[model samples]
Target: MSKNILIVDDSMSLRQVVSIALTGAGYNVIEAGDGNEALTKLNGDKIHLIVSDVNMPGMDGITFVSHVKQDANYKFTPIIMLTTESQQEMIQKGKELGVKAWLVKPFKPEQMLDAVSKLILP
Candidate 1:
């Protein structure tokens, strides 16, 4: 069976780009508009990884990561933050929240895929 990955971002275009890349690479992709939506999607699903944006309307990536780390089901799932923010503080916070990788926005699809491959659960 293919691995499942969640792509959480407010931008529809960004999610489309990510979904295309992952699906083409033989991974099933789940898309959510924000952290709340992502949480809703996680229940009952064996998500292999998460690609999230740092700055979102409802729940930001750092906060979302914290919640995921706290959840018994998804605490071990890897998270990659795909965001426009480059602040060291935010990066540090995300790291503390169990985010495995931090990829800034305007990123190449290949880079994202590489990170996913490195962190995705088997």
Candidate 2:
């Protein structure tokens, strides 16, 4: 199956890079600049997984994840934090909000693909 994946980041470069990588890997990619954009896209698309950056201009990744998990309609869609924050507290907070995985920034395409495959396919 071609998975529909959402990539949310405030960095335009990061969003482009990740979107390209995921598209090349055969997944349908949706790019969002911030949490609000991500949520808007979620309303119209059937996204299988969400990869988001922790820090954003409006509605951070942590807040986004909490909102997504709280919404009964999208509670089952898996989310992974792909950010520069390696702090344990931040990771724990993400887990509390129902994030499936946490990946530190400067990630390789292989690493992102691996995590997505594991979450979506397993």
Candidate 3:
């Protein structure tokens, strides 16, 4: 079966871009507008990977990642941060929270897919 990937971002266009890429590559996609909504969507689903944006209204990507890492069910799922914020501090926070990869915004879909190919759990 194809892997299920959850993408959390406030921007609908961004989500569509990502969804198109992943779905084109034979992966199923789930979208959430923010971290809070993302958390609610995680209700006992067999999600293999997550892609999130950092600067959101409530529960930014970093905090959301921390929560996922702490959760018994989703702790081992790999995550990628796809955000406009390229600050070192933000990257560091994501790394500490066990984000598998980081992709700054306005990214090439091919490059993002490469990271997904590498980091996604089997």
Candidate 4:
């Protein structure tokens, strides 16, 4: 079975872009507009990885990661923070929440693919 990826972001364009890139790389892509939506999807899906953005309307990426890590069922899933924020504090917060990797926004498709490939087996 193909690896399933959950992409949490507010920007439709970014979600589409990431979906396209990952789909081309042979992974199933699921999307959520915010942290709440992501949490909802989490219950019904079998996700192999999570790619999230830091700033969003309701729940932010850091908070989302925190919730996921706190839940025993989802604690071990690999999550990558993909956002424009490059601040050390933001990255550190993600690290504390068990985020597997952090990639700054405007990242190349190949860079994301490489990260996912390394994290999830094909």
Q: What is the C-alpha lDDT of each candidate?
A: 0.90, 0.89, 0.92, 0.91
How does candidate 3 fare on TM-score? 0.96
The candidate maximizing lDDT is 3
Q: Give the residue spans of candidate 3 off by over 4 A.
A: none
Under the 3 Å rule for N, CA and C atoms, how many clashes does model 2 have?
0
Query: What TM-scores do the predictions have?
Result: 0.96, 0.94, 0.96, 0.96
Per-residue lDDT tens digits for candidate 2, residues 14-120, read 98989988899899888899999888987855778889999999899988888888887789998889999999999999888889999998999999889988998
In angstroms, the error of model 2 at 37 is: 1.2
Model 1 error, position 84 (Å): 0.4
Instruction: Supply candidate 3's per-residue lDDT for 12.
Output: 97
For TM-score, the strongest prediction is 3
Clashes of 4: 0
Candidate 4 residue-wise lDDT at 94: 82
The stretch of ten residues in a row with the least summed lDDT in candidate 2 is: 38-47
Give the C-alpha miss distance for residue 60 in model 1, angstroms.
1.6
Q: Which regions of candidate 4 are displaced past 4 Å?
A: none
Worst 10 residues of 3 by lDDT: 89-98
